[model samples]
Target: MDVFEVVADDVRRDLLLALRRGALTAGELARTRSDVSRPAVSRHLRVLREAGVVQSVVDGRRRVYSLRPDALAPLATFLAALTPPAPPVPARALDGLDLEVRRTTRERRTAHGAAQQEESA
Candidate 1:
């Protein structure tokens, strides 16, 4: 299953959110969801595990689940490529303009009512 496909379900997404805090056994994950039964939650977890978004580790008799964040790398990379980068600042945008210096000089002259000596280059 595509990583995106597995996450399309709300339950699977919520399971991922819960797992983000830390690992939890299947029973614990199921308890966190009041709407879904344990069996249903297990199915959702199965999908997530198959999709590579979650991983399970057997601790004695308990099966612990945790999010596999690296699994989202492909999705993130796709999104970053989909969005265009900001246009680069034009190199010569203000090349010939000394408007800032001129404005400051004018403001100083007006506010002080006296000509200010220009700074030496």
Candidate 2:
């Protein structure tokens, strides 16, 4: 399967995310979530390995897997291209709002000061 097809599966995606932290054995990957069985995880891992999304190494009797981040460069670049640039906010757009806030603050302070003076008198 291709990278896109391999990643389309939720279990395979989860396995990739778990492997992102570091290399993990099949058992370790299986333990990442409780919903999937060990055999299911192994199947997902096999698909990922076949797709070049993950690399595996023999560590004694265990096979450890790690994410091949570079393999995802095409997908990342494609997604980045698809994202539209953010629209720029016009300058002074909030000037009226700012002025109203300042006016409200001044009015409140003046009213408070007048009340205090009246109480003292």
Candidate 3:
């Protein structure tokens, strides 16, 4: 099974999340959740191991499991590509309107000053 297929199950995903903190024995992983049986957790662990999503080491009688982060690189890259880019800044339409209004006011003031000077003369 590939990494996607292996992590498709919620129980298996939970098991992976538990292993992310550190290595844990099969029993320890099973105990992390109360809903699933130990055997079921073991089956999920087997799938994860088969997919290269996790690696196991025999520590005495127990099999300790830990996450293999490198195995998830492809999935991470795929997800990153799917994420939408940030929205662009909006155009300042009001700024141009404000400049036009100021120009019109300045023009009217200058015209009024010229008319007053002509009347006085």
Candidate 4:
């Protein structure tokens, strides 16, 4: 479907990793694993190509599949945006400081009022 969905598949992810080393022909890719048939590998490559995660070009008579580095741009951007900024002082921490200041101000005001009442008496 998309780049993330395409790479979410184990087969497709493996294919991309393999291509990272160098471009590999479909047959070569199939031969690398015993469980996967050549046709299956080809199908996975087709999906990757559609997602733009992989690209293929004719080399001699064979089509070699390679990773498209640009295709990973979306993922990189998404991850970068998600990274949290450096932690600054928290609101709760500031709230304690504010409370202390308010308490001291109230005490000062009450003490001043009491002194005035004493002087009047």
Name the 10 consecutive residues with the lowest summed lDDT in model 4.
Answer: 28-37
lDDT of 2 by residue, 1-121 (tens): 6787887888888898998899999999999878999998998889898889999999999999999999988889889999999988676888888899999999999999999999999
Q: On residues 1-121, what C-alpha lDDT tens digit does candidate 1 reach at each position?
A: 9987887789988899899999999999998898999999999989999989999999999899999999988888888999999999785777546677788888987866543433332
Going through the candidates in the order shown, the clash numbers are 0, 0, 0, 0
The residue ranges of model 1 lying beyond 4 angstroms of the native Cα positions read 82-121
Candidate lDDT (C-alpha), each: 0.88, 0.91, 0.91, 0.87
Predicted structure 1, TM vs. truth: 0.66
Q: Over 4 Å off in model 4, which ranges? A: 83-121
Q: What is the TM-score of each candidate against the true structure?
A: 0.66, 0.69, 0.70, 0.63
Candidate 2 global TM-score: 0.69
Error of 3 at 106 (Å): 40
Ranking by TM-score: 3, 2, 1, 4
Weakest 10 consecutive residues of candidate 2 by summed lDDT: 1-10
